[model samples]
Target: MSGPALPPDVIEIRGIRGFGRHGVFEHERADGQEFVVDVRLELDTRPAAASDDLADTVNYGVVAEQVHQAIESDPVDLIETLAQRIADLCLADRRVTATAVTIHKPSAPITVPFDDVVLTVQRRAGEST
Candidate 1:
């Protein structure tokens, strides 16, 4: 795949919720919790804008489903890994030059009170971290 000609427009998808059994503690893996994900894709939308066709751009609906599926399917230990998995999902589209994935674990097992726990990951095409 080639790089975008333009600086790349941002397509943001937020509040993607899913139930996942992901954590280090045994109870966390067994009981599970709701995970909220925010995905931002950097891509050139000019092609789709000009052609007025769905095929010319990334279909966010499909992307959301894929992310949701990944959350429900696998049991990973770290949110970092989960974020990377989501980033990989977004970068799967050739049109997406870069992606930012923010994973929110609201019901985390923290001793102290907190509003939320979040992990954000940034990835570019053809790179893994």
Candidate 2:
């Protein structure tokens, strides 16, 4: 017989905005920029649903705060690094089997007119990449 079925549910947190001083250019870091983050967490919600308890599932409020903190503090030179940090934070919760983190810089330091620069990183429970 097969083991118990896992829930194929995803929790999406979108448009998390924060001020971050991250970039290659010195001025970019000095001036700082607005960063928006979106994350999709893959987890089994069956336990939470059955118990109807917040503890049985990942607390997204805490996750949002953690992601915002990652963006606002410990400025990095690359959005890749920042995205990885956010992924790591989300993966910290054992309930989350995988996570997709998207970082958007609307005010990128580009001479030409551009809408936005975005970087996304995906991480699984065990693998770093």
Candidate 3:
């Protein structure tokens, strides 16, 4: 008789926050700014779960490093661009089924100081064109 198939598994990473210089304003972009980023990654890991192999599933450390790199790598004109780029990067991995990205800017340049501004985006691997 054939052995039963392995059950599907999911690998998740959360609460990865960092400070970076990203904004539209000249000073904000020039001098740099602070940003908090949170990300969630969903993927299938039946192989890894059964085989106990790192290569069979997504790596949380790698994902976190990638998100961090994406945020600090290039100057973005808008947070929207930054968020979208992040989601796209996570989705690039065939193993990742979906990804959620949340970015918070607490020190946004404004006439009045505010608590914070948060932007969240969710994208599925196939749903996005």
Q: Evaluated with TM-score, which candidate comes out highest?
A: 1
What TM-score should be assigned to candidate 3? Answer: 0.82
lDDT assessment of candidate 1: 0.93
Candidate 3, residues 1-129, lDDT tens digits: the string is 989965435555665666577887888877876777887778776778799999987877888898888878787888888899899988888988788888888888877868998899988889854
> How many steric overlaps are in each model, in order?
0, 0, 1
Regions of candidate 2 where Cα sits further than 4 Å from its true position:
1-7
lDDT of 2 by residue, 1-129 (tens): 999986569999999999999999998889998999999999999899999999999999999999999999999999999999999999999889999999999999888999999999889999856
Candidate 3 overall Cα lDDT vs. reference? Answer: 0.80
**lDDT (Cα, tens digit) per residue for candidate 1, span 8-87:** 79999999999999999999999999999999999999999999999999999999999999888789999999998889
Candidate 1 error regions (>4 Å): 1-6
The window of 10 residues in a row where model 3 has the poorest summed lDDT is: 6-15
lDDT of 1 at 48: 98
Give each prediction's root-mean-square deviation over alpha carbons.
3.6, 2.1, 4.1
The 10 consecutive residues of candidate 1 with the worst lDDT sum are 2-11
RMSD of 2: 2.1
